[model samples]
Target: MTMTTDMTNSTAPVKPGTLFGIPVGELGWFASLLMGTAVGFAAFFAATFVGIISIMAINTIGHHAIDYSLAYKRIGLPIGLLVIAVAYAYLATLWTKRILRKA
Candidate 1:
């Protein structure tokens, strides 16, 4: 037995738009870039903050156990910030898509 599917009937149509003379398909790329920039900025700041704290703790405390604890503490903030930024970017993308759907 042979089965056939209608490939020609399975494709959806594309919508068109222009932003400052750029095509709508390019908007998805633009949105991705913007999200990446935001996340990168968040990570940069988080890492800077964590690094400064870790340095100060190591200089002042100067104990092996305390150093390990401080290291973990210093890492915690950046990890949390990265998680939040990723979630925010995901939601932002969904929101953008929803808004675009209505247009």
Candidate 2:
């Protein structure tokens, strides 16, 4: 029986004009940074909105009011939004890599 190696360079070929090993196609770092940041902020706001709605719904079900002031003061929403934003930024950067790769 013939044995085959798993770590072969038989992967798909890479296109030209890639930055950071990502096929961004001559995209500058500054632009990509801004794009990533925008994506992060978008995710942050979207997640925050959904979280707030969910919190309000849950609190209402228990006959409790949503304490907006306490929520912000406790940094719950802020922390969660920050984490989601960072994750989105990372995904956006990864998506950018795929953008030019397909072109």
Candidate 3:
């Protein structure tokens, strides 16, 4: 026998997932980190592409002149870390407020 419970008319409020006993709620820090990773990856690829193109054009195909570290280390990593931190902080505050209001 198989039985399924319908959730359409349920009146209970769904609680968001938590982390470290703190209610991260929706758009949690981990999710933000994942998003930041995606953003950072995109940034790194775009920056590398542009830098490589610029070096090829300006340096007249100087095969050994391009520095790849600038894109991922200096730009992309920092941006990703910043986004992760900022998003986590912002979401924490926002969710805290929303939860408090509901309480």
Number of the top TM-score candidate = 2
Error of 2 at 7 (Å): 39
What tens digits encode model 3's per-residue C-alpha lDDT throughout 30-62?
A: 665565466556665666576656656755655
Best lDDT goes to which candidate?
Answer: 2
Residues 1-103, candidate 2: write the lDDT tens digits.
Answer: 9998788667666666454576545455566666556655666566656667777887989888877555443444566567657755665666577676768
TM-score (all chains, Cα) for each model: 0.36, 0.47, 0.46
Candidate 2: regions farther than 4 A off: 1-26, 69-103
For model 3, state the Cα shift of residue 3 in Å. 51
Better of 2 and 3 by TM-score: 2
Model 3 local distance difference test score: 0.61
Backbone atom clashes (below 3 Å) for every candidate: 0, 0, 0
> lDDT values of the candidates?
0.59, 0.62, 0.61
lDDT of candidate 1 over 1-103, digit per residue (tens): 9999866766445555433454433345456566556666676666657766776777778853344444345665666567657745664565577578879
Rank ordering of all candidates by TM-score, starting from the highest: 2, 3, 1
